[model samples]
Target: MASKLTGTVALVTGASSGIGVDAARQLAEQGAAVALVARRKERLETLAAEITEAGGTALAVEADITDRDQAEAAVRQTVERFGRLDILVNNAGLMLLGPVVGADPREWERMIAVNVQGLLHTTHAALPHLLKAAEEGPRQVADIVNISSIAGRQAWENYGVYNLTKFGVNGFTESLRQELAGRHVRVGVLEPGAVDTELGSHNNATIHAEMLDPFNAQHERLVPADIADGITYMVTRPRRTAIAELWVMPTDQA
Candidate 1:
């Protein structure tokens, strides 16, 4: 059988580890030329080597998505190397949750920059290529998957800024989907809940300790591959199908 994504090109931001890394690998396994973008050169290089060694096309792009120039460069490099861009996964994000009243203002700014602005920068740069790729490509369709959080859908006391950024991502993804629907460019959002990743590492010690209570109580914490599975399903669909919004949470999660 022909590979689902044969002859396609995909760019995944924050692909050094976690969900982004897994998604890139899964896409490559389906036959897309994968560009892995992240700030950690060593990690990106290692992952790229693994993918290439496994008979998949892979490129390591060291970039900070928060930097507009770097973000744009990553997308340009993908097109320059692969000749077209079929998938853009805006997976780079920051989540630092704490009480709104005493939370460091800097943390809020950082979340906004990485979670919101970074997505905008990458999407803005990749839009033209994605639209063009949809015109004529292996699948005749292109996809942009923005990684959001369950917090985007609901508000909690201490997660004010993180929720704000994710909510912005949801709105942005929906608006872009509407704008690009006629063009055959599918835009979607993947919202995951309490995944076992480094997302919580940025939280302050106090907040971390506070989070441990509920986090530990939940026996079934989600793995990175769980989120990757949802993403893979989204992009691997036939050109005629579009999964606009996907919410994935551990079955035990409530």
Candidate 2:
């Protein structure tokens, strides 16, 4: 039997746009109170308003998950406002693609900070509350869904650093799932391929001109909602079933 998410509270990072935004809306539709976190306050406020007007509960939490203190505070604020945290979607990430040689080192640093450290910061802060909710909240199981990418499974030449961060996410999620299985905290990694997101726009001019344009041209891209549907399915599974990982790609891509 599928588990219903009624009366549950879910915290979603990067809720300002793309897959995160779609996932937040979907969770609300499934009867969960959503805490939307993002660096863009206005965007978060707008999304929250839309959800609330549709008869769902939403909170706009403005925080850059890259900062450890801000990440912890986001989790604390969600628990304070909603009384518990039943689900955490670590969807905030920075994707900068370029070749390792002669690439702007700063871009690599930013990617690591946001993609890897940011996930760790939020997950660490939310883990305790998630475990508590699993033990005593309305739902007997809690979930932590980390958004990885298909790049995690296979590396591309110019996308080296981005692939590194995603691969790290995959390993970290698997390890966390093993550690938390006994506690009923389900940890999952969602790997998506060639999604039509703002991800490529973050690349430097050199890489964008030389690599991104060509790569995007050849791929049959997916929409953000497609990835959100995968997340919804994973979280809605019965307590006895945990979807450890999912890989989603455009049907015509391969």
Candidate 3:
């Protein structure tokens, strides 16, 4: 059952919208007390209310996880609210795409800050708690799920920076998985292709119009809940089972 998180607590970053919020809801539905982490407080609060109305426990934590202090605080708040964190979803990231030749360095920096640094900060802050949870939790297991993208696997001209960040995520998750396996803290990555999120809407106007929007209009996209479902499956396995990686693509996305 997806709605059975009776005693677990989960922290989902970027939980204001899209894959983040939906994944948080899925975890909450599955019986976990969820902590919603994102910079946007109002949205997080709204999502938290909806989860509560659905008879689930949730905490809305406003945090820009790109900032290390905020990331630490987010994890601390989760531990304070529910005593332990059994699941950590590092889903707080953005992509700003353009050709490397004339791209703004700021864009690259922003992608690195959130996609790479943000994930790192959250994972680092939550690791100790996750380790402890694995030792003293009802499920006898813990999970760290990093959200990546198809760009992580394939590089394209305009996707250089985004690709770099996701590849970093891939490498980091694998290394962490190996380090934490013996401790029962399962670490993994989810690579979803062309999800129907507002991920590209934030790109520079030129990139959005010429690069992102056209492609988005051409293809069917996976919804946020689709990725959320993947996350739920990864984190809910029995203590003896660990799903190392998952790559789900839209039927039309090659």
Best by lDDT: 3
Clashes of each: 0, 0, 3
Candidate 3 wrong stretches, greater than 4 Å: 1-3
- For each candidate, give its TM-score against the true structure: 0.98, 0.96, 0.97
For every candidate structure, what is the RMSD over all alpha carbons to the true structure, in angstroms? 1.0, 1.7, 1.3
Across residues 12-51, which tens digit of lDDT does each residue of candidate 2 receive? 9999999989999999989999999999999999999999
Pull out the clashing pairs in model 3: 4-30, 5-30, 5-31
TM-score, prediction 3? 0.97
How far is 225's C-alpha from truth in model 3 (Å)? 0.4
Q: Which of 2 and 3 is ahead in lDDT?
A: 3
Q: Which residue pairs collide, candidate 1?
A: none
Instruction: Kindly list the per-residue Cα lDDT of model 1 for residues 1-254, writing each as its tens digit.
Output: 86899999999998988999899989999999999999999999999999999999999999988999999999999999989999999999888877888667988889999999999999999999999889987788999999998998998988898899999999999999999999999999999988888888777787777885568575677899889889899999988899999999888775
Query: What range of 10 consecutive residues in model 1 has the weakest lDDT sum?
Result: 212-221
Candidate 1: deviation at residue 126, Å?
0.2
Candidate 1 global lDDT: 0.91
- RMSD (Cα, Å) of model 3: 1.3
> What is the total number of backbone clashes in candidate 2?
0
